[model samples]
Target: MIKRYTELADAVEHLLLEKNSEFICYLQPVTSREAALQWLAQYRQQYSDANHVCWAYIIGNTRQPQTQAFSDDGEPSGTAGKPMLHVLTERELGNCLAVVVRYFGGVKLGAGGLVRAYSNAVSQAAGNAELRMISPSVQLSISVSFAFEARLRQLLQQYQAALDDVAYRDNVSMQVSVPQDAEPALREQLINETAGAAVIRQVASHSGV
Candidate 1:
């Protein structure tokens, strides 16, 4: 999965100095397509007079329902947008938007230069930002009798589980976020800890931000 930040990333205002051309790349975190579009609009106004405002965004996880968009902004069709999108896809980055604004210098860069420039801009920006993994988490409600409450709390602490709610009835209901992969292990542990007394059930699963 593509993370928001990279441990070691490089940043530069312009990649090519000889051509007198300048490129500004901005890497922003965006959750939805609307947010991505809004960021594009904001940059459009910020660099209204620039020659090109090319951009791309990846929203969602690696599995499914991932949304992506790109625009060449008057550059050769597919030259700018597709290249930018390629960088995002190849890097496996999601929930992020990258905008590359170029102020055309006197000289013209061929199609190859254009593609390389846009792709490099994004890659460099990604390098400069920190990247982290956001895994899928599930909340499970576990019930235990008051007799086992103290031991249950100790087990929860050992597992680094969070208590969502509690009831003073004969049993206590506690909710905890468990990693998807660790759910089975957690369930087994809980069962063994409670000696089949406490029952653990999944309440919900979601991708955390």
Candidate 2:
């Protein structure tokens, strides 16, 4: 089962220092694997002078994580990326990416120190970010009469649904996206409101918002 997940509202930054070495961590919001890679590439290019750009990301639905990847960026075998990945996975974050850019100072942090620094950097950013819950929903298309349009829209509010698309023809055609759990009740309400005139069909399922 998946708990509620949140998106990072804005980019977050955290800094960790060990023996004069500066680790600048960036937490960026990413909804897809492609987006994650794109953002990482942008960061790498922007910080081309930095020592290392270690990164990790979790992309998928609330119920299940789809794709995950982490890179050490030459930090060490098990130091930078894996610890950052652990923080994201343990929190069950959705569509999130964690990148820690290291600017090596004169000192060298050991493997354990690197692990703690990387994990703490991501964790601190997560704490400071604005997270939005990932809501699971189903897409549905409904057909109803023009006269019942207003009522159908009202019923959507009560049924926890959102209106996606609508068309005015001989009758009214609409595409609505409703919560997966509330579909049954929403469908029942539609039938009663339209007096059997409303037709509802499941179109697709969305993993998260």
Q: What residue runs in model 1 are displaced by over 4 Å at the alpha carbon?
A: 1-18, 62-65, 191-197
Q: What's the CA error at residue 2 for candidate 1, in Å?
A: 12
| Model 1 lDDT on a 0 to 1 scale | 0.74
Report the lDDT tens digits of candidate 1 across residue range 11-69. 22334332677778887777789988998899899999999899988787523426888
Residue 129, candidate 1: C-alpha displacement in angstroms: 1.1
Model 1: lowest-lDDT 10 consecutive positions: 2-11
For each candidate, what TM-score against the reference?
0.80, 0.80
Q: Write the per-residue lDDT of candidate 2 for residues 160-195, one digit (tens) a residue.
A: 788889998888888888877788888887888678
